[model samples]
Every structure is written in structure tokens, then in C-alpha cells.
Target: MEDKANKAWTDLIQEYQIDNAIKQHGEFIIQAKDIKKYREPRLMAKWDSSESLPTILKKSDINILPVSRSAYVLSNFKLYQPFPENDINTVKYVPPLPLESIDFNNLSTESNAINAMLITGILDDFLGTNNTVETFNGRMGTNDFSFTVNLTNGGKRQVDVQSAQLEIDGGFENDDSIIIMEAKNVPHPDFHIRQLYFPYRLWCERVRKPIRLVFSQYIDSIYHLYEYEFAKEDDYSSIHLIQQRNYSFQSSAISWDDIQRIIDSNSPEIDDNYDDTSIPFIQADLFTRLISLIEQLDKVPNMTSAEIASSMEFDIRQASYYSSAGEYLGVIERPLRGHSQLSLTGIKLMRLKLRERRLELIKLIVRHNIFHDLLSQIIDTGEFPSREAIIDRMRRYNVCKDATTLYRRASSVSGWLRWIVTLPDTTEEFE
Candidate 1:
């Protein structure tokens, strides 16, 4: 049974290898071994919530400070420098993109989406460096190498990863360096360093130019690009974030007045179709996250909670929250007694025009009682409501919580409403 379970887990990981570069890069993290051996939730005991125990041990059992020892003790550990502070004064100009003429309805594949960005000059705008394509979908290295993987949990083993199967979606040559890219459709908190490391290594051997590793995500009509480099070249685990920024091919500006109109209407006639009980009203970017969930469902319909969590590299609890949000929007369903799947609404959502989809979401929010009532009040007031005012509104609706929790929930409500009101239009301008 254990053997079967391990195989199942490995298979699940393989299924989620959307691109060859990411897949090959992940091998160093898990080392082609059972995932159970590398679970590192235990390292979070010192700073994680006091409400629950970590997966590997009790808080009292661990003696070392996690800030210093996390990488030494946990497999797939990520070490990041201080986050880059947002500087509003330094905003760069985002020129118009070539995506204006492309039809999003037919842009289903990752390669196609990537090509659109390239042709549209998004790469140059976001990275602040113009580049020409050097190679696309190419491989290097011979298939005859085995290395010992030093496990974070104090173990070492040999594994054969034949020739490093180095693949990159797009390689760009700028003025002084080559940028090796690994692209994904979803934005993740962190990525396997191997994705950038192996390619950087292979190319360094073939060319004298400096190599820069880039991870790109195209989501919700915006492009998020991150650049990374290994602190110690040839060290698969030395990846660190150099810089990260978000850019939109078109402006995503939305105004408070625009949101007021939606709040004052009955376009979304309330119905008994939504289930808000299991959904959190306080999550960050809940609407966009829900849309991302729908995209995953569109790719692989009828995935269980565990499968969805694994595929998206989210914790099971987080996966549940996203799935529940989809259910609340009436975009997902469970035709089988125990299995969850996309409903007719979700399918139609995938097929609709992008503008139509955003409108549908606005209508859905206006149709929900809590969102509708609260937003109506906020809209009626000429200014942004205070946190106290928001919490008071929540209290009136029986969404009561403790002081801290209420404050956080209120912030979420304000942010989400702002996001809804400011939903970007599909209209575009060509350079």
C-alpha cells in the first residue's frame, strides 16, 4: 500500500510538469523520491500559527532557529532575500502591446500565450531590456550522469537524471547576457531552483555570454515576471530572487464610480445557487484566484481536492478554499456523489469572450447578499469607508469575529471591492 501511495504521488507530480524545464528542474527538489521523506512543515513551528502542530514534529521538539537552519533541515527549502519594496516614484512606462489584434478566445496553449507576449513587446517593457530570440524548444547535454542528492532531512542518495534534459521555452539574447526562460500560466510563491540552475549551467558551457534565469506567469490579462540567479554557480540550491515586477499589456485601471453602478443594480438577480458557507470572504485577490481555479479546471476537469492542491502546488486547505470559491460563484459542481467537477456554468465561462466573463463575475458579486448589501452602502457614501465602518457593517450582517480577525476581514472586503470596481476592460492600443 505504501509503495502504491508513493507511486501515486510521483505520478501526480509528473502530471503537473506543465513545461519540460520546470519538470527537469523539480527533480533536484524531490530527487525522484517519495515526497513523505521531504515534508518540512516541521520547520515552521517556531513562527507558524500556535493553533496547530506542524506535520513533522512539535514546536517544543525543535531547538534550532528556523531562520538560520531551514535550508539545512528541509528538502525543497526556499531562501529569499528581503522582498523588494514597492517604489511608486520609479514606475516605468509600459508602451502599447501587439496583442491588440490577437484573439484571446483561441489563445489556449502556453506557447501561443508566450509568443503573443514576445510579438507584443511585453518582454522588453517588463524587463527593461530589449532581447532577440536565440533558441526555442532546444535541448543539450548527453544522457549519462548520476549524482548524489543531499537531502535536507539528513540523508543522501544517488539518482540517475540522465543528461540533465536541459530544455527552455524561450532563450533571449540581450545586449550583454542571455535570458533563459521557464514560463507558466499560474503565479506561484516560489519555484524550484533547478529550473533556472540546470539551464544556466548547460548554456554557460556552450556560450561566453552571461546567463539570466527568468520565470514568467501570464494571468488575468497581466504579466508577472521574476528574475533569479544562483548565488553559487553549479549549486542547484543557491537560487535567489534578483527582481520581480508585474506589468499589464494594457492598463488595468478601474474607478470607484464604475463599481458604484454595479452595486446599485439588480442585474445579478439573487438566487439559491451559491454556497458561501465554505468560502472565505477575507482572502487576498479572491476574484482573480477564483478565475485561476476555473482555468485549472478547464485544463483537467473533475479533479479531487487533493489532486487540485497537488497540481497547483498549494496546501490542501488553500486548494479547498479556492474550490469553495468556485462553488460559491456557481462555476463548479459535483455530479458524482464524492467527486467535484466543473459545471455547465464553468464550461460556458471558459468559452465566453474575456469581456463577457469579467461582466459575468461582476454580476455574480452584485447578486450575492453580503457583497451586494455592503458594497451598496460603501457606494452610497462618497468616500472610502473606514475599517470600523466596514466591520460595523459586517457585524450587522452577523459576520462577527474577534477584533484582529474583524480588522483583517474588513481590509479584505475593501480590497476585493476595489478590485471588482477596477476590473480591466478588453480594449487595447497597438504600439
Candidate 2:
């Protein structure tokens, strides 16, 4: 049986087709279930007798015309009105604790993530405010309230928010206005607009002062804050980013020379008997990108693979790849099958000073016999070897046990080691 949402969607499709009153507005997707149905043997059998599959599909109730196996559009689909595009202009500012010289020991004691942001003084600079600040947390209203939200499918319906709990990570009421903030340890391409809208509405109803919605993120050891506002008062989806700024403290935690020294010290000792199929071989570089992901896990411990994927800007497969890389590095662990959580080593790294943290992470990788050997070869040869070289190197040790598995792990080996060759310059300006 179809669920309520799918059934309602079917009903909408039927009504529009029967009435010939389709509105070419709003965003909609042909549900995956229907797409799967179209792939059935019975459905494929009819393809030869009929016109092209997309032609037949257009006449059906699904209301989508397939452009390809992975692309499609509603029969009368029209693009949703897009918000204005603005350049993300940034002003560089210095952090109070040279971002590089952060004392992880002292920072670990701070229980509140918001306070930690404040102490860094980056928040003050980002907000353009040095006034004393006050924080708020917990529910904002005494009674539940019902509201309506515009759906992407060209519809609106009433939604009941119970207690409308307003969990503000960092908020401050200044003399002129109140700033409501949502903070994250890692950056994302976009966040659910409701993170700011719900509080904005609740507080606007309670107080006469204007509310400023701020989204703050800590990525690459820098604090980035984006100010957003709803262009339309009642439309939740109308949220727009108005301002963006980033700040970083001084950092010299790792250098090219440091990476070289570590790579040279750890020579590749082939462990032919080592079975490493449990972990994936790296497919992407950008070690700092992976570190930002680790920082995200540190912020929210024990997230399932799906949740981690949903929280990030990338696709689910990419999320799986990055998480797998973390697992191979031993910085992340999956205690339960299919569910990933930070390992003790990861937790310790999060608590150590920046320089110590960088060095320790290097030590962890170099200590691993497989990785140590790979890095040594990369540093010694001064170039990335061909895929065949990686496969040949792994074959000597019988790592991964089979050619297919060995090939996959080789991708990881080359992908991860590539980061050392192209580490980003930390001293350069950042936003």
C-alpha cells in the first residue's frame, strides 16, 4: 500500500491530468518508487510495442518525461523562482588565539560549543559586535502553535509544532536587536532554513526588537558566519543569505617540511600477510576536507551513515567514501555495522592542541605499516605511481586477498597519500 505522502502525490497528479489545469510552477520529483516500477520486466515488455519509453511515460499518471536514465522532468515542469544571487564577499580578520596556537587542553574543559566560539573572539569579529552577550536555550512558547509552510510541490499545508522548542546554540540580545545563531563545527553547502526561521518567528512574536538570524560554522580551523533573512514573512523557504564573513586565528601546526620528515621516517615495510579489506582505499585527496568532516563528527558524536550524509552538501556516495577514508585512517570507527562513530583516537585528537593534534595524526598514519610504506614510496619517488604500481605493491604483500579487492584498496592508498603532496597553505588569507 502507498503511504500518505505518496498517495497524496498520486492524487495531485491525477487531478492535474484530468482537469488539464496543471500549474507549471514549483519544484517536484518523480518518486523513486515509481521510477523503480518503470524498470519492471512487465513494463519493459511493452516498450517494443509502444513509442519510446518517455513518450509512453508522458501519457501515464507519473507526470514525468524521462530525459535519460537518471534525469527527468514533470510533464509541464517549470523552474521554481530562484532567490537573488549575491557574491559572497568576505573581510579577513585575526582570531584572538592565533587559530594555530589554540590550547586544546583548555578548550576541552569548555562544555558549551557556543562559549568556545565566543572565547575564540572570532564570533565578536564576525558579528561586528563587542558588547556583552547573553545566551538563551529551551522552549520559547507556553502553547503549541500551528503554521503553514510552502511545499516544493506547489502546495501548502498546516503544520503543528508542539511546544515549538527553540534550541539556540548562541544568542545575544543587544541594545538594538537580538542575534540568534545556529553553529556547526564543520561547513555545509546549505542548511535547512528552518534552523533560523522557527526561532525568528517565535521571537518576533514575543518581542518588539528586531531579530538577526546568524549561521556560524567552524571549518578548517576558521569560524564562518552567514546572516540570513526570510524575504517573505510567512514563507519558510524564502530564507536568503544576506552576509557572510570568516575569521581565522594564527596557525603553523603543520608545514611542508614536517610532512616530509614524517614520510621519510616511515619506510614502507610490506606486510604481505596483512588483511586490510575491512577498510576502503582512498579515492579522493584534500586531507583538510576530511579533517573538517572529522570536526563535524566531533561536534555530533554517534551519527549514522545516513545522518552524516544528509547533513553534508555532497551526495550519499561521496559521504560514504569520505567516511570510509576516515575509518581506514583509524580516526573514525563503526562500532555497529553500517553506523559510524568517532574512535578514541579521534576524540583524543580533538582534545589536543593544534600542533600536537597535527603531529599525532601524522604519527598515527605513519605508524600503520601499509600507510607508512605508501608514504615512503611517494616521498622517495617524488611522484604518484601509476595504478599498476599501487596494485603491484599491494600484490607483493597479498593485501586485500583478491585482485578485485586489491584494486579497490589501491584507489584509497593513492588518494590519501596525494594529500601530503598538495597540502593547502595555512598562512594564506582565508574566509
Candidate 3:
């Protein structure tokens, strides 16, 4: 799909002399009809992030934005903004209301997660507001508006819009302001500003109250909310983060004793002759990202490798690494036909509550000899084992023979161990 889009755009650009036009005017407005000559404008223009841009546009550092219902503007401008690093250490656990109807364990969509957050009062707590009501949402046509965006060349371009379509995942209003939220279920490093900017500009014209733009992402059972503001309302590039918060309905507090208990418990021993060579050694580092990948697999069964890479915003090779890591843990089945699906074990693991799910994950990781031994050493010494020590263990177990591979895999081992040790203790109360 990406290649096809790239080819279409490349053809369109050459045929229409868009490059020359942008060179002269600093921007080029291409109508839907002109784009439709090669490909559907909707498919060609729907780049949600900078990484998703077609080769020509990305190489030229050009961004595309809808200037009107029938036209799009292309320029060498900064259109995508990176999300701030999420500090899960500061996550606040907001208990679910007694009458909550949403089954958070099976959340499959952004709407489901957002609704759960609202019902549990996570949104209200994060926003410091009460009686927040969902007022306007879904696709709406924008009224005529204009904004200025900074170009990569340190120049500015004026953008005008008339009846261009914009959608709000959720629009919540309190007495003081209207919150325009753009929700995403899959994690991405950054997002296109148009998702929030268009709705914000439209709402500002419609409402007398202040318009607050928020980006909501639900990943691995955590709802990350980021509130952003345009310092200059009419400047598209003026968007900046005001504050951000992480929230969860489940308890994120897991004590060291809890990990210790898992280490000491008597469980079925791993097969002694299990072939380590059958699967790739773990190179994917972030444990939470692994869990997030599993969650995505649970939601959409039998996803192709390409779909996984596109949906997770990972490269094809990284997708393979995570898929192999999942298979190594005996929770994912990648068939010869190239479709990846959760194994029976993975499906059952997903059904467990947050605490049990996490514990089950820990058990799965430690079931392997290397992680088990490393975790035991950590418990005994109260310190992480050295890289050399971990690499030696990998060598001894015949995990990998290549020195570079061993070092990379050792780093992954250290990362997972750190994640286990840093779990917040449940006994501590958060005020």
C-alpha cells in the first residue's frame, strides 16, 4: 500500500510540475481532481504521521494539508509534532466506578478506552474539572478559516480553509472550556497537527469558551492524555504541550515481594531440550511495547506481518523481532502463510486482569533459563548483573554465537530485568 501510494504521488508530482510550483510560490495547491487523475485523493493525502509520508514528500521535507474542501497545500513546513516521553512512573490509578459497564480488559478500539476513562473519572481528574459532558463529536465541516504555518526555510505561508472536513474522536465540554480530543489506539512517535488543529480552529470560531486540544492514546491498558495549546491561535506551528498525564484503572503498584513470590513459586519446569535455535533471540527491548503488541494481536486476530508493522509504526524487521519474541514466550503463533496470531496461551493471558496478566507475563519470561537465572542473581545481590556476565550466560547456553548479537540481546535482557525491578509497590498509597 505504501509503495503504491508513493508511486502514485511520484507520478502525480512529475506530471503536474508540483516541485517547480512549490519552488516559485513556497507552496502548491493541488485539487482533488488533479490528484484523482492518478489515485484517489483521499488515500493519497491521508498521511497521519511524518513517517507515513510518501518518499518524494518525506525526502523533500514537504508536508500536505487540506486548504479547502477540494484542494490540498504542499510545502516544506513542519506539520508533524512529536509526543513527549510518557512517564509511566507517575501514572495515577483511578479505580473504576461501581456501575461501570465497560469491560476494560477487552477494549478493542479508541472509543472503548475513552469511554472507560470518562466513566472511571480519569478524564475529569486529569483535566481538574467536573460534570464534563460529551457534547459534539464525529465528522463536521469546518467554517472558513485561515492560519499561518512556519516553513522549514524559516518562512511563513498563509493557509485558507473553507468547508474542509474534520473529525473529533471525542469532544467534552465543561463550564470553562471545550476539550477537543483526537484518540488513537495504536502508538505512534508523533502525529500530524491537522488532526487537532483543524477541529480546534473550527471550535474556536463556534464557541465563546477557550478550546483545549488534547491527544489521547490507549496502549497496554494505560490511557496517556496530552493537552496542547496554540500560543498563537492562528499559527499552525504554534502548538505546544501544556501538560500530560498517564492514568490506569488497574493498580500499577507491584511490590518487589510480588516479583520475589513469582520467582520462588513452584511452577511447571520449562522443557530441558526446548530448541532455542528455533526462534530468534530477543532484540526488541521495551517490555511494555511487547505487551502492547500482544494486546493488538488479541484485538485483531491473525494480522499479517505488514499489517503489524504498519499498525504498530514499526519497521518490518522490528515487527519480525517482536513476533519472534512473542513466539519465544509461547504466546504467539506465526504460521508459514505469514499471518501472526496469538496462541491459546496468549488469548488466555489477555483474559486475565491487569495484575494477574502482568504476573503471568513475568512467569513466562522467567520460565526461560537465562531470564530466570538473571532474575535470581538480581534478587540475591540487589543489583543488576553486568553485561559481560549476561553475555557469558548467553554464550554458555548457546543462545547466540555472534559477539554483536550477544551484546544486543544482553541489552534486551537488562531492559526486561529493569522493568521488573522498577514496578511500583502496591502497598504504597498515592494521594
Would you list the clashing residue pairs of candidate 1? 254-422
TM-score of 1: 0.62
- In the range 339-411, model 1's lDDT, one tens digit per residue, is 5678898898887655556666776767766678666765676466677877777776656456776676676
lDDT at 182, model 3: 92
Top of the candidates by lDDT: 3
Instruction: Identify the superior model by TM-score, candidate 1 or candidate 2.
Output: 1
Error of 3 at 262 (Å): 5.2
Could you tell me how far off, in angstroms, the CA of residue 71 lies in candidate 3 after the best superposition? Answer: 1.9
Ranking 2 against 3 by lDDT, winner: 3
lDDT of 2 by residue, 22-98 (tens): 34433243433554443432222111111112332334422322222333334332112232221332334454544
Candidate 2 stretches greater than 4 Å from native = 1-111, 142-163, 185-190, 218-222, 245-327, 331-351, 359-431
Per-residue alpha-carbon lDDT of candidate 3 for residues 1-431, written as tens digits (9 for 90 to 100): 56667788888888878888889888888999998888889878878877667777787677888877789988887888998755446677776666656676667788888788777777787788888888888989999989999888888888888889988899999998899999987767789999999999888888899888889988777778999999998999999999997877777667678888888883535432325457777887777768888988887988887888777765566678888889988899988656889999999999888878888889998887788888888889988899999888877777877788889988888878876876654322223
Per-residue lDDT value at 402 in model 3: 76
- lDDT order of candidates, top first: 3, 2, 1
Task: Give each prediction's root-mean-square deviation over alpha carbons.
Answer: 9.7, 11.8, 4.1
Name the candidate, 2 or 3, with the larger TM-score value. Answer: 3
**Runs with alpha carbons beyond 4 Å of true place in candidate 1:** 1-103, 125-131, 134-167, 174-176, 192-194, 228-255, 267-285, 299-301, 373-392, 400-415, 421-430
- Model 1 scores a C-alpha lDDT of 0.55
